[model samples]
Target: MDKANQTIQITIDADSGIPIWLQLRNRLVYLISSGGFAPGDKLPTVRELAVSLGINYNTVSKVYQDIERDGYIASFRGRGTFVSDAYLKNEGSAENEADSLIDDFIRQCRELGIPRQEISALVERRLKLTE
Candidate 1:
């Protein structure tokens, strides 16, 4: 396996009820944030990733577009896609970065059909576990 494939250990759980695109997007975000991929690291092309993951090309393309819009990655015509430097710069503001992460988490939970109260309760439980 290549470096990108080795570094990114994403798995699609069709039985988990989560959309494949969301799972892939979330995993990529987490990998980027956690330093699994560095700035300027090249990611697989949309068509390549789609074929590798055995999913529709449109799905991978959508995930890449969404992530690029969020400043986590960038694409260059002919050169391919790469991890963006913006995520590294955003790390300078820890508070804002944390808030953004929380917002993303909540948004993803909502997308998964989780209720607001349930989300809050889940957070509280997780917080208590850390205490």
Candidate 2:
């Protein structure tokens, strides 16, 4: 795959009130966890990503470092960074993947200014509709 083209899928919202680094990191985590990126998939370099997103190189570098530490990606000395297999090992079942996705959803809801109680109520209502 052309890693450069893949960067098109990532976008930054300057008006979102969230930190740019957090936005990038969250998007990457979401992509990886949701299987938009598979294990061993090559990631764009920090410089390339920064250029593509029009952000400072240091910001992308920092997010990469943090995500690498979190075990979501691994960087080889010369081969570039790739999506880590850690999540594959950790999310061994559909249930576990669901749990991770739910955690992401809750975090996003909170970020959107939804209170926990309201989130719970919304979830309950949605579940009832399905039932």
Candidate 3:
């Protein structure tokens, strides 16, 4: 994975109304699932992430611990933390994978009363801004 020198970017919303730890955890899960990181790829240290997010070190540590407990990542005492293989996406066609994911999201949105047009707008905007 060679993450020792890899650069990772995380966008934080201090005002998202969600707890920072939860937001960070979700971002990490998405990063792992969206192929932004590979299984076994090392993550920033707790201290590093805390400093990066301008939050208390314990907060980042807690998020890491929670995600690890959720099987999204694993920690090796000497080697550091990494994206766990359990969260790894299937290694097949990337386009097909993305389509499947999008379809699932759309299905959930439909059930939640989000119209197709609204979903399309949201997806397009998010893809442009976030991806």
Candidate 4:
């Protein structure tokens, strides 16, 4: 299958404190931010995703709706849902999102009593791995 037609996998925990739909949406956001979905890429239909993930159609639909509202995806009648190029035009939105995630990560680590120096070292190491 082509890149746009390939099935992307996302795990959900029905029993987790977080809602399953939120999990799906957050994962999608992370994937999009990490360049998994490219400009004009087509996402699987809500029905397809629901069946693939074994979840309710409405749940998947809700996630898609939210993502669309976030300006990450767009739908065209009869053309299917596509990755929106809005974020490309709104450059600050993307960077600010990545920054917010990093800040949240740092806060969580701090709450867990992880030292800033250790966090910095770990981030540097992780960044190197991505390269």
Is 3 or 4 the stronger prediction by lDDT? 4
Clashing pairs in 2: none
lDDT of 1 at 40: 85
Candidate 2 residues lying further than 4 Å off, grouped into runs, are 92-131
- For 70-120, candidate 3 gives per-residue lDDT tens digits of 567899999998888764444456875587557657866886799989999
Worst 10 residues of 3 by lDDT: 1-10
lDDT of 2 at 71: 79
lDDT tens digits, residue span 1-131, model 2: 56566688789998998778789988898888887888899999889899989999999998889778667899998899999977566665888658755876797789889999999999999999999
Error of 1 at 82 (Å): 0.6
Cα error of candidate 3 at position 40, Å? 1.5
lDDT of 2: 0.85
lDDT of each: 0.84, 0.85, 0.75, 0.80
TM-score of 4: 0.64
Error of 3 at 113 (Å): 30
User: Where does candidate 1 clash, by residue pair?
Assistant: none
Candidates in order: C-alpha RMSD to true structure: 3.8, 5.1, 7.7, 7.6
Local accuracy of candidate 1 as per-residue lDDT tens digits, 1-131: 36566434878889888788888988888888888788888988888888878889999999999889778999999898998977666667879768876987898899879999999999999999999
The CA lDDT at 99 in model 2 is: 75
**Which sequence of candidate numbers ranks them by TM-score, best first?**
1, 2, 4, 3
Supply candidate 2's per-residue lDDT for 22: 81
Candidate 2 positional error at 1, Å? 6.3
Segments of candidate 3 deviating more than 4 angstroms: 1-8, 88-131
